[model samples]
Target: MPTGLALRDPRQQLFDAAERVLVRDGPTGLTSRAVTTEAGVAKGVLHRYFADFDAFLTGLVLDRIARVKAQATALGETAGTGTVADNLTSALMTSFDPVMVSIVALIIARDELRTRLRTAGTARFPLVGEGSAMIAGYLTAERELGRIAPDADIDTVAPTLIGAAHLLFTERKDSPPEPEAVRKVVTTVLAGAMR
Candidate 1:
């Protein structure tokens, strides 16, 4: 594939390198040297794309946030025939990537950076919001089909379901929760809450 000077924006290179380093070695491995080496760029090149370490870190978080939101938004926008659990499952599952979790952890730890990110509006991509919206959509469909309870308030319920998913995905252990365990938590919560 065509890359390097063929790519006009060096920022994309930094982002791509950041993604790889983050997935492979987690957030602590995201150094300018590491990213530059991964991108095959001179160490100084990282500065041209990013103002500093903090800026690059902010961008890293924002990039993952955008991806998660995009995934949830696309799933929400799609017109699919399935049970409420299925649609909710699709959106909730996307939130499990290590990339997003690592970003969230860094943002939470760096209050100054997190503050700048919030003020810069990089922290408001609505990742969880998108998942909630997807759940709301599914619940609406279920209600229309009389499969979900008429009294159910999707706006409230969706976030509750997403919150559970967040906790399950955030588990830090030598052995992370299995896919089946995560699915069970999501499905059980949705089943009880939907109808």
Candidate 2:
């Protein structure tokens, strides 16, 4: 019998390395060589796992989306355990991390990669849409717990918060917003909805 979990997933390791390269060097620096070097694997490792660089890029974006979605789900799980502002701020911060920002930049700058992502059935890259839904779900749970106004329009509030945070993260590419700034945005967006 194997002791603990002996087998490791190479794909996850590669994805982590790719993320490091992306955060440190931006989209332009995310070549196969760079990814492999960062991962401590041969250049052929990525190609073996993915069809090509475009495939790898798409996989990375999708992986990140899934991760954010999982986090959103967890937020719903603990709806009433923490302050609404704190919870919202944590969710927004996770979405706007440096690696995620770099991936967004990569998708925008590389037309080929974008085409590949579209072909993968993410034409609009529904990260924001999915995130909005998660936020709405969390808000609904909070409202049920008497944490928010009974009449709060959750649908509208969710998108407003997501859109503002997305814009703030994208616009401030060089200087990511501070925690206070994110908190301010969260507070502002939640004012009408929160009790």
- Choose the strongest candidate by lDDT: 2
lDDT per residue, candidate 1, 41-113, as tens digits? 7777777667887888777766766676666556555534665566666656666666666665566667666
Scanning candidate 1 in windows of ten residues, the lowest lDDT window is 122-131
Best by TM-score: 2
- Which residue pairs overlap in candidate 2's backbone? none
Query: Local distance difference test, per candidate?
Result: 0.67, 0.83
Model 1 Cα displacement at 20 (Å)?
Answer: 2.2
Global CA lDDT of candidate 2, please?
0.83
- Model 2, residue 149: distance off in Å is 3.0
Off by over 4 Å in 2: 1-7, 118-123, 170-176
TM values, all candidates: 0.75, 0.83
